[model samples]
Target: MSADDSSATARDSLDGGAATLTTRRLRYLGAALATLVALLHLLDPNHGLLELFALLYANPRVLVFDPRPAAFVVSATALLVGVSLSRNAPNRRPYYVAGIVVALTYVVGYLAWHLTGHGGFLPGREPLLHGVAPVANVVRHLTSDPWAAASMASELGLIATLVALLRRE
Candidate 1:
């Protein structure tokens, strides 16, 4: 091939590679943002915006004989597995499952809070409903207290793993 033709081909290839890298970076950023928001519920557990909304809307009461400690252990284990899976491949299923586990643990914590009538023990509060309706009241009380730090760390780990798995030359 002529030198000019070869040079042009190389430039086009380089441009294509760069574009692909940019797209992957953007996707990773999006995933990280999502994971960050979810994890925030665990880190602050009380004041985070998303957590507050969930607490006000759901009004989940703590179940009698709550099993949060056990749930935490299980969720943590799942998080580790999720991190491993993420490293191997962009396994959406495991990531989603881990997210659900984290969410459920928070639910258990909220239920415990309701049964105990102890706001301090949990993350957020049930908003006051001024004669709105029993249903509204119930809805307002649903809440959970997933640990923000652990959740955030797990999410970050997953993001890192995903990025590594998706990396290309």
Candidate 2:
């Protein structure tokens, strides 16, 4: 081939490699986000350390715990599945489906619960602040409460990952 053709081929190959690298990086990021979501719930500051320990290890309410715990578990499982899928494991469709379903469910359920006046375990946890000043709520949580911010971010990341996995490149 001519030098021009060779250069074009090399460039195309580099572009392809970059795309693959980007894809892999995104997958790893998605998993990391998922892990963060899990840790946030596990280390939620609202509950005491003993309460967290009891809830995870010695409490009867563990099975029927609140949405936060459920959300974390689902996110963690999705992270695991995402990692496994990255390894080129066969039968990846189910894993993808599970991740999408769980992430979507958590997002919708968490939002609905908060919006419907049943948000927090404590009393009167309605989203009045959000209703009055949405930006304020976002800014407060993003700045003061990193766990909440990370939870929201991880949901978005998982959603993006789900869409990317579903779509053909």
Which candidate number has the best lDDT?
2
TM-score for every candidate vs. truth? 0.33, 0.58
What TM-score would you give candidate 2 relative to the actual structure?
A: 0.58
* Clash count for each candidate, listed in order shown: 13, 0
Give the alpha carbon lDDT tens digit for every residue of 1-169 in model 1. Answer: 5564465457658897674566456546535644453444433434444344454466635322233433444454455455446544533444644544455555555544444453334445453344545444434554222354355444555445445433321
Give each model's whole-structure lDDT.
0.47, 0.58
Cα RMSDs, all models: 12.5, 7.5
Pairs in steric clash, model 2: none
Looking at candidate 1, the ten consecutive residues that score lowest on lDDT are: 62-71
